[model samples]
Every structure is written in structure tokens, then in C-alpha cells.
Target: MALEQLSALKYGKKTDLSAKLMNIHTKLRRYAAVHSGHANMQTTLCALAVDEDERAFAVNVGDSRMYRCRGGCIRQLSTDQSLVQMLYEQGRITADEKKTHAQKNVIFPVLGNASEEPQPCITEIIGGVQRGDIIIICSDGLSDYITQGEFEEILALPMRLPRRIAKLAEAAIKNGSPDNVSVVGVSMV
Candidate 1:
């Protein structure tokens, strides 16, 4: 339902995307609060949008992610909202420990209600989206299983956008993904 609302909007500039995302979250939060048995229900989102000048912006909430492949390397464009990620960022935990943390799956900056939980979602401007760059928006199921090197390897192949998405999703499941996998890919031509 949140995804459906996001798909219908226009995106441009940092403020535009920020306000739109917040509005969507606000509306969805109200709906879920009144109708849902689970008051804390939340979901993740990862999106890439292009403006009239062709500038790209990435926005995300929860643990979903957006990645940009440029100059032969893939970079994560979105930050995770999980507690494990926060601990690692603050130097309280190591990279390996982030994976093994007891609350590894506790995600934050949730879309449900920011008033109840005070974490702001992240938004980033994707600089210099070039002809050969690739952008991928995906769920954790895909992001967790696809390593940096493997992503580079698969994306280096001479395949169309749809085929690349297919292979990536397939690889995630083959790698024993514990949750649903979804991927959207675009190779900037």
C-alpha cells in the first residue's frame, strides 16, 4: 500500500523527496494505527528518482537499500536503519559483530510512527549519474546475500536491465535468503 502511493508521486530536489516521503509515511501510519492490530507495523522502502535536469536522488527507510555502480565499483547509496548498523557506525561494534548481534534484525526509522520512535529516514543525492552507471533498489533479502564483489561480477555481464534483476534475485534465493526477495535495476545508457 505504501509502495503503491510512492509510485504515483513526482520526485525532484532534496526537499521535494523528503517532504513526499514524510507525507507518505504520515498517511500510512495513520491508516495502520487505526486499522492494524499491530500498532508498530512498519516496512522498508528504497527508491531512485530522476529530475528534469537528469539529476538522481535516492531515498530509503528501514533496511531496504539503493546501490549505485559506477567506475567499476558498486557503492551503497542508502543507510540501514537497524540497531546493528547504528552500533557499528558508532564504533560500539565491529563489522562481524554487527551480523551476530542479538538485535541484528531490529530495524528503526520505521515508516509507522516517528512520534513514537524518533529516527529520521535518510535521503541522498546521487552525484553524476553517468551513461554506464547502474542503479539497483532492493530489499534486504537481496542486499544481504549479494556481496560487493559478486554484485560487481553479475552487473559486469552484458545483460539487459531485466535480466540483471532476474539473475540478482535468483542468486539471493540460491544463497539461502531468509526472507522475500525483490529487486529493481536500471542501467543508465
Candidate 2:
């Protein structure tokens, strides 16, 4: 459903990206409610859209993340909407503590939350995606096992995007990621 909405939005003008994203969330919520019996099926979503002017817009739900690497440095662009993230944001726990927290995997805002509307974080990169910048979107299975510094190093390598993405997935698997790992890499040319 999300992909269908996104595909429909792709042909339209870029001015209404956020509204389109919200609509997608609403549609997904409706679908989930209609299929409430399959309660175990839930998904984290993170999407990025780059315009012709190099502006980037992102919408994220759950623990999946978006990262931007520029000038040899990497920074996360999406905030994790999980219990541990809330605890860290509230200063109730340190970053290291949150990493090992018992509820690290407890994500409240997801695609199928029937009790409330999913609140996705929307971010706009105003001329921030310059040429040579690398954008990465990944699931928690990869981010949970890989550090930002490690992403920086991997992205900085003089390899093709596919190879770099493969290396990242391989590294996460080697690091004992128990969940499914997925990564998408886009390099601004």
C-alpha cells in the first residue's frame, strides 16, 4: 500500500510530498485495521525523495533510519520512534544505556498501530544533498549492529554503490544481527 501511494506521488509535483506521505500512513492504518486479525504483521518504513534541485525529503516510522554522509562524515536524519529512543530523548537513559535497554525493540509508532495514527517523522534537507553525498536508508537489523562511524568508513570507500551496500549487509550479518537486514544506498552524482 505504501509503495502504491509512493508510486502515485512520484508522477505528481513535489510540493505535496509531506501530505502524500501522511495520506500513505492513513491508508496503511486503514488497511491494518481491516486486517486486525494478522496482528503479528507489522513493518517499519523509511522513505527518501530527492528533487531535481538536490533537496531531500524523508518520512520515517518505527526504528528504520535514514542517514546522510557528506564530506567524510555521517549523520542520522531520522529519529527512531521506539521506547528506548523516547527514554534517551527524555534524558532518562544515556545513549549507551539505550543500546542495551530491555525495550530497545519496542517501537510504538509503526505502520499498523490500530489504537492511534502512526506519527511519522518528516525531514527536509534544504540543499543539503550536494554532489558526492551518500544517502542510506536501512532497517534496524543493520543499524542496530553497525555504528555511524562504521557507515562513514564503508560509504567513503571508492567502491560502487551496490558493493558498498553488500558490504554493509554482510558486516551486519557477521556481527550477529538476528533480524532481517536491508539497505538502500544512493549516491548523489
Candidate 3:
């Protein structure tokens, strides 16, 4: 199970909210244990401190990634815990082979492990969210079916948040997603 959290404060210092962030992340991980398939899943939490005062948080898990699109470039804030990733790191697999690997879908780590230290990997990004900054969280199902360019195109549309996310999910489903697909997009005002 993985715990996911999203929080923001406009006036207070972020250091004061560390405890709250930790608590929220703990809860999200507990929830994942109850719902996700892998009993020993490992989760990664990707968060960002939005605004100059660093007051926002975003949490995520599994292969569902959080992307930051800024300065005309996109960066992935989360890493996938899959065998394919391992192979890639070991130089046993190539970028092209990553997609068709026999263990591509296997999650290497997630939440609910029976280990002693049961902890979720957390990432915190500081600074404020700019007007044009884009935050996207989505399952691998969407990434697998759509090209990066296609995703950029879909996200670049002027549609509302719900509609845009729905469209992304629909696209993945139409492209034959064998697993559940989920996506969340946030743009700071």
C-alpha cells in the first residue's frame, strides 16, 4: 500500500507542516495496503512545495508518475519500481526493450512489506508553482499506450481538469489497458 497526500498553505512556513505531511503520507500508504494487489508493495511519494514560500505537497505511488512541465521541458519526479527498471539500470535492457520486457509490469517494491522499518520513499520539491507550471500524475497504462508527444498534446489542451484527465484515461482504455488506469493533474494558480 502507498500513501498519497496533497496539501498547500499560503502563509505559514513549510517546516511547521512536516509532521502533518508525514501523517498524511502514513495514512495513504495504509490505504494502499488495503486496496492494492501487491501485498508487499513498495510506494514512492513525490511532493512539491508550491509558491515561493514552499507550501504545497503532492504524493504518489507505483509506476504512476508525477511530471513537472516547466521551461518547455518535462521532468519525471517519480521512479518506477519494476524489474524492467532494474534491468535498465543493470544495462541488461535497452530503452526499446523496456516496453516488451517479460517482467515489465512486475512491481519490484510498493507498500505493506513485512519488513521491520516499513517506510515509504518520499520526495519533496521546494519553491512556488509558477502560473504555467503543470503537474501530472498518471499510471503506466497511460504512458505505455501514448507517445510522449501525444501526451503533451492532450495535456496542452484548454479543457477543464476533470475533462482532461478523463480524456487521458479514455485514451489509455481505448488503446487497450489491461489494468486499472488513473490520473490526476494540478496546475497552480
Candidate 4:
């Protein structure tokens, strides 16, 4: 479904992509609910769309993330829709506390059996990408194990995209990630 959204974004208007994404979300929710008796179907998702004009659009649900790297600095573009994040936002916990919070892994909005509409975090990069900028999309398995400083350190390395992505996954495994790890990195030329 995400791939279809990306393909649509390539040829469709950026402003229209949000509605398309919402449609996809709705379908996923319905499918999950219908198949609940046959399969375990909850999931966190993060998607990125880069248009011909080089602008970037992101939609995320649950704890998956998207990040932007430029000038040796890495910044997270997608906020985790999890209980820990909400606690931090409400000033009930410190940033450091969030990392080890017991509810850190408790995601609030996931793609399954929804009683309410899914609220995906959507972001737009207005001027598009520039040379030397890097974009990364990954699941919580990778983000949960790697610190932001570690992400910066790895991303700053002068390596090809495939190697960098491999190294990111390797680091997560080495850090004892208990979930599936997926990472995709794109370097803007």
C-alpha cells in the first residue's frame, strides 16, 4: 500500500497525497479488523514520498520514524505516537526518562482494529532536498536501539547508501533489538 502511495505521489499532486494516504489507512484498518480472528495484524508504519520537484512528504503512524540529515546533523522528522512520547510532551517525564520508560514501547496509534480514525503525522519539506542531505526511514526496532547521537555518527560517515543502511541494522542487532529491524537511507545528490 505504501509503495502504491509512493508511485501515486510521483505522478500526482503533493496536496492530494494526504487524502490518498488516508484512504490507504482506512483500508488497512478495515482489513486488519476483518482478519483479526485469523492473523495477528498490528503494525507501525512510516512512509516517505519524494516528488519530481525534490520535495519530501512523510506520513507516519505508531512508533516508526523518518529522519533528515544535513551538514553533519541529524534531526528526526516524525514523532512517535506512543505513550512515552505523550508523557514527555505533557511534562510527566524527562527526555532521558523516556528512553527507559516502562511504557516506551506502548504505541497509542497503530494500524489495526481502530475504533477511531488514524491520525498520521504528516510533514512536508517545502524547498525539497539539497545536495549532501540524507533521508532515513526506519521502524522502531532500529530507532529504539540507536541513540540520536549514534544516528548522527553513523550518518556522517562517508559510505554508500546500502552500506550505511546495513551498518544501521547491524548496530541495532548488536544493541540487542528485540523486534524486527528495517532501515532505508537515501542520499540526495
**Model 3: residues >4 Å from true position, as ranges?**
1-52, 55-61, 71-73, 115-119, 124-128
Q: Which candidate is the best by lDDT?
A: 2
Name the better of 1 and 2 by lDDT.
Answer: 2
User: What lDDT is obtained when candidate 1 is compared to the true structure?
Assistant: 0.79
Candidate 2 residue-wise lDDT, 1-189, digit = tens: 676667667533346765666677677767766786655445678878766766677778889998888898988888899999999999999999987898888887576566666777777865567788888999999998998778888887798999999999999999899989999998888
Ranking by lDDT: 2, 1, 4, 3
Q: Name the regions of candidate 2 deviating beyond 4 angstroms.
A: 11-18, 29-41, 51-54
Candidate 3 vs 4: which has more TM-score: 4
Residue 180 in candidate 1, Cα distance off native in Å: 1.3
lDDT per residue for candidate 3 within 37-139, as digits (tens), equals 6455444444444435555544443466777666546667766667787789899999789988888887644433344322333465554356777787777
TM-score of 2: 0.86
lDDT of 4 by residue, 54-158 (tens): 667777877889888888888788888989999999999999998889878888756543655557777776545678888898988898899878888888778
Measured against the true structure, the TM-scores of the candidates, in listed sequence, are 0.86, 0.86, 0.68, 0.84
Quote the lDDT for 136 in model 3: 79
lDDT of 4: 0.77
Candidate 4: clashing pairs of residues: none
Lowest-lDDT window of 10 residues in candidate 2?
Answer: 10-19
